[model samples]
Target: MFTYDTTRATAEAFAVAAPIDAPVSRGRRRIRELCADCVRIVLADLLLVLYRLRTVGLENIPTEGGALVIHNHVSVVDWLFVFVACPRVPRFVMHYRDYDRPGFRWLFDAFGVIPIAPKKEDPELLARADRAIDEALAAGDLVVICPEGTMTPDGELSPFREGATRIARRCNVPVVPVVLVGLWGSIFSRKNGSPLSSLPRAGRAQVSIVAGPPVAPGRVSTAYLVEMVTLLRGRHR
Candidate 1:
């Protein structure tokens, strides 16, 4: 089952801050950004209607400024859920393979998702991703990353990778932990077999998304994130 955080610290940590720095010049660049926001608004509305999504701790998310939004990966559409719940349109860090997929390449391109690969496979690409993340954060853009790196084979939360922590430390940004529950057994999840092979289960699935307090860059770690996410997921029998 999923759980919510109601502590005073969590509440105080997310007190709204002033808007992020908007240094973009007027003209094509500004117009493009506005168009993207419009698309996200439409998509978020559609998702809420289709899945009946429920979100908690939205106030825990800072309204503006740079943040490393971290979440446990469960379904292929997990990012979509997080995007809908967030106050800002975050640039997601995606696996290069997923970003290169023919069918979805356009979407990734349009959203400016950062594509990253394993260091061993492509050190250059990894370096580029790091630089991109740093630049985005400096520009006051929230960046979303799935710490698990890949989807979970089962419903259990996997150990988070170090990338999220490293990025937060490098960029000096708060690491916000968000968890998506009730996604297992869905068509986008690897419940019965390969994901997407089976038809969607009947009825609108009830999904609970909880956002935890932002962990400071110095205090964030893989183990800490794992524990926080596990607590958020709670005991599912």
Candidate 2:
């Protein structure tokens, strides 16, 4: 929905305002120190029971260090699948509206999710998100972003946004591109109609997550990320 210029311009402005060397807040720093294994285990098990999840190339996720994770936006539960598949608990950049959801407010806060508004709508929120992402990476934490900006209206990939690439380039971190398969028809997805409007499919859905090796910051771009994700999705298609 956002034009390339708007997204890139906001990101560029944020990069200028918030240098990569900026310090992280004490509260944020302390939260990142705590292990989220318990939460991760609980959510991963729940998803496993509900959907037949298959993962490949998880080894590509670095055991330690700051890295940028870029993935396709498919379903509302896509982040859950990503959390389950990754070795570390990643701090995600989520929409501010989702963060304001009544029931999930605590979850997002506890997990240190960064809330962002679209650049065109609220450049201030986007600036804060960019700073948060830069600080998190500077603190040597894993950060995940869905460059498609929102879930797909159709079951096909959307053009990538420059925000993710901008963050990676500014922080000089590796970007890992991942693709999720077989979630398009699920109740959580915008498939067949409005999400949650139709009854959930009868049986457990089969899902797969494929990850490609990390792309260096210098080499990573929106176009390259789109190409990699398209190829990965093609494997399952």
Which tens-of-lDDT digit does each residue in 103-204 have in candidate 1?
766556545578899999999889888888887888788889999887999888776789998888888999888888889999999998888999887888
Model 1 worst lDDT window (10 residues):
11-20
Best by TM-score: 2
What overall lDDT goes with each candidate model? 0.76, 0.78
List pairs with backbone clashes in candidate 2: none
> Which parts of model 1 are misplaced by more than 4 Å?
1-29, 235-237
TM-score for model 2?
0.85
Off by over 4 Å in 2: 1-35
What is the C-alpha local distance difference test score of candidate 2? 0.78
lDDT of candidate model 1 versus the reference: 0.76
lDDT tens digits by residue: candidate 2, 1-237: 001112222212212111223455664444433424445656666877788877888889886799999889998989988886877668888998988899876656656788899889999888878888887888778999999988999989888778988898999999998899988988889987877878888889888988989999999888888998898899865
